[model samples]
Target chain A: MKTATFLNRDEFLNHWQGHRKLTRRTIEKFPEEEFFTFSIGGMRTFGELVKELLTISVPGLEGIVNKDDKPFSHDIELADKAAALKMWDEQTEQINELYNKISDEELYETFNLFGQYKDQTNNNLMYFHDNEIHHRAQGFVYLRALGIEPPFFWER
Target chain B: MKTATFLNRDEFLNHWQGHRKLTRRTIEKFPEEEFFTFSIGGMRTFGELVKELLTISVPGLEGIVNKDDKPFSHDIELADKAAALKMWDEQTEQINELYNKISDEELYETFNLFGQYKDQTNNNLMYFHDNEIHHRAQGFVYLRALGIEPPFFWER
Candidate 1:
C-alpha cells in the first residue's frame, strides 16, 4: 500500500464533505411520500437508500481507521426517516472526529479487513472516497425522478 | 476538468466482470435458503443487493454514454428478485455493447446527463468505477456473515 497520496486528509475531507452536501441537498428535494418508495424494482425507496448511506460510512470508515473488520450487527436499524437523519448528522460529526485522528502515514497503510474479501494489509484509502461518489450518482437519479435538479456535481 | 485516466475500456470490463464473479462467488458460498433472507437491517439483502447492482452499473453506464437518463420503467413492479436479475443481465450485456462504442477521447468530454449534473466527462467515467467498489464492500460483509472469504479486492 504505497501512498495514494494525491490529497492529504484535510483536502480529502473537504471534497468528501462537499460531495455529501450535494447528496444531502438532493435528499432535501425529494417528495416525502416517495422517500420510501422504490422507483424501480428492487431499488429501496429514496428514503431507505438514504438511511443505508448513513449507516455504512461512519461505521465503514471506522473499519478503515482501525483496519478492523468488525462484524456488522443485525440490530442496525433506524426507527424512521427522522431518526435516520439524526443518525446521519451524528455520523457526519463522527467522520470529522475520526478523520482527524488518522495520520498522513496511516492513509497509505494496507488495511486488513479480515474474515471477508480483501486479505491485503496494504490498501489504497481512495477507494472509500471514490465509492461515496458512486452511491451519490444513484442519489442523483432519485433527485431527477422527483423532478428536482441536483446541485452541480463538480462544485468540489 | 483534467484528464481522468482510468483502467482502459478493456481493463474496465475485465475488472467489472472480475468483481461480479467474486461477488457471485461470495453469494454462492451462502446457503441457498439464506440467500434471499440475509440483511443488515438498513443494508439490503445480499440477494436484493446483487440484483440491484446488476441494474445500476451497466444500465447506469449505458445511460451516461447515450446521454439518456432513462429510468428502468419495467422495474416499476420490481418487488420480485427474479425479474430484477433478468433486467440486471440484460443491462450488463447492454453496458458491454455501449461501452465498446466509447472511444478514449469521449471519456473526458463534458457530458450533460439529463441536463442536471455536469462535470468533465472523464470524471463521470471514474464515477462508474468507484461506485461498484463501494457497494462491493457491503457484499464482503455479507460474505463474512455466512462464513465465506471473498476474493482479494485488488485482484486486478
Candidate 2:
C-alpha cells in the first residue's frame, strides 16, 4: 500500500494559509452582532465557528511538536470577535514557529494527535486544514444568510 | 524554506476517501428539491456546488497523470440531483484509476492543473480535497437552512 504525498511542508503551510486568508475575510464581513448571534437552523454562529478553528490549530500543533498528550480543550476564553482575530494572528505565527520544528522524517512517523487521532503527522496536519474549511464554509453560509457576499472562494 | 511531508499515497487516498464519505452523507441529507434549489444569499445551490467538485477532481487527476493541459470545463451536463450522485460515483472510480498511475516520484513533480494553478502534483491533489471541503461546507449550511441536520463533521 503506497501512501500518497499530498503536500510537502511549505506547500501544506501555504495551502493552510490560503484557507486562513479566506476565513479571515469571512470573519471580517460579518456584522458584529451577527458574528456572535446569527444562526440558521440552530447551527453555531460564525464567531463560534472561528473560535473552533482557533482552538484546534494552535493547541493541536503544540501537542504534535511537544509530543505532549494534552486532551484537546478550548479553555482560553476569547472576549469577542476582535479578540478572536487577534488570537488568530497570534496562532498563525505560532503555527509557523512550531511547524518548523517538524522535520520531513517526522511527518511520516505516526503520533497520537491530541491523545486521540493517531495518524501520521502529515495526516493530522491535513485534518486541521479540513476542519477549518468545514467551519469556514459554515461562515460563508452565515454571510449569505445575512445578505452579504462572501469573498470569492478563489481569492484565497 | 522547509517543506513538510504529510501522508504517503495510501494514507492520503484514505484521507480523501473519508472526506468523500462525509460529503456523500451531506448530499444524502438534503431534501431532493432543497438540494437543487435552496441557496442562502444568492449563492450557488448545492447541486451546482457538487457540479464544481465533479468538474475538478477527475479531470485534474487525469491531466496530472497524462500531462494533458486542457482548459477547465464542466462538459458533463448533470440533469438533477440523482444524476449528480451517479456522476459522483463515476468520478470516484475515475480518481482511483488515474490516481494509481501517479508514482511517488511523480508526486513531487509540478503539474499545471486545469491549464492553470501551477503547482506540484501533491499540492494540486490537496486543492481538490480543499475545494471539495469548501463546497461541501456550503451544502452543510444549505442542509441546516432547510432544517436538516448534516452528518457530523468528524464522521469522516
Candidate 3:
C-alpha cells in the first residue's frame, strides 16, 4: 500500500481538539430538560448521544495506547448536563496526556481498537474524532428542532 | 510545536473515502421530495446541506493544490439531488487524482483555504471531512423525521 501524505500527530490532535471544543459548546447550548429527554424520530436523546461519545473517546484512545483489548462500552453514568460537561473536561485532559505517549512509528501499526475495528492506529484515532462529529451533528439538529440556535460550526 | 504521530497520506485518504461512501448512502436514503423540502426548526434542507458539502470539497482541494486564493463560493448550480450525486461521483474521482498531487511536505504548508480558513493544508482538508459528517448528521435527523432509516454510522 502506498503511504499518503498525512498530518503530523500534533496537527491531528489539534484538529481533534478543535472539534471537541465545538462539541462542548453544543452540549452547553442544550436546555436542561431537553438535554436528557429530547428525541427526534425515535433517535437517542442528546444526552444519550453525548454519553456514547464520552464513552468512546478517552477510553478508546487509552485502549489504543495501552494495547488493551476491551470491547467497546457505552456505560458512562451521568445524572445531568453538568456532570456530562465535567466528564468532557476530564476527557479533554486525558486525551492530552495519553496522546503524547504514542510515537510516530506506532501510528502506522495496526491495533484492534475497542476489541474490534482493526485498522492502523492512526485510523482508529481518526475514528474517535469522526464519531464525536457524527454525534455532535445530531446535537446540532436537536438544538434546531427545539428552536435554539446552535453555536456556529466554525466557532471552533 | 511538537509533531504528533499521524496517518500516512494513503491512510488519511482512505479514511476520507470511507466516510464519503457512507455520506453518499445517506443522500440516497433521503426521499426525493423531502431531500429538497424537509427541515426541522428552519435548518437548511438536506439537499441544500449536501450542496454545501459538494461545493466546498473539490473546489477547496483544487485551490489547495493550485495555490489559488479564491474566496469560498456556495455557487454550485445543481437542479436537484440526482444532479448532485452525479457531481459527487465526479468529485470523488477528482479527489483521488488531486490528492496525490499534494506531497507530504505540502500537508504542513499553510494555505488560505476558501479564502477564509488559513491553516495547514491538512487541517483544511480535515475541515472538509468534518463538515460533511456534520451535515450528513443533519440528513440522518431528517431521514428519521421522515421515517426513513439512514445508513449506519460505522458502515463507512
Please name the candidate that would achieve the greatest TM-score relative to the true structure.
Answer: 3
Q: Residues B62-152, candidate 2: write the lDDT tens digits.
A: 8888999888786568777788878778877888889989988888887777788887788778778888898998888888777778899
Residues A111-145, candidate 3, lDDT per residue (tens digit)? Answer: 88878778888877887888889899999989988
Query: Each model's interface RMSD (Å)?
Result: 11.6, 2.1, 1.8
Model 3 earns a TM-score of 0.95
What are the Cα lDDT values of the candidates?
0.56, 0.82, 0.86
Using Cα atoms with residue i matched to residue i, what is each candidate's TM-score against the true structure? 0.48, 0.91, 0.95
Candidate 2 lDDT over A1-156, as tens digits, reads: 774555567877877888888888888788888788899888887787787788889888888889987788755677787888888888878988898888788787889888889988887888888888888888888887788888887788
Ranking, lDDT, top scorer first = 3, 2, 1
Interface Cα RMSD of candidate 2: 2.1
**B12, model 2: CA deviation in Å?**
2.0
Off by over 4 Å in 3: A1-5
Compare the candidates by DockQ and give the number of the best one: 3
lDDT of 2 at B121: 83
Model 2: lDDT of residue B122: 82
- Candidates by DockQ, descending order: 3, 2, 1
TM-score for chain B of each model, two decimals = 0.69, 0.93, 0.95
Residue B131 of model 1, lDDT score: 49
lDDT score of residue B149 within candidate 3:
89
For each model in turn, which proportion of the native inter-chain contacts is also found?
0.03, 0.87, 0.88
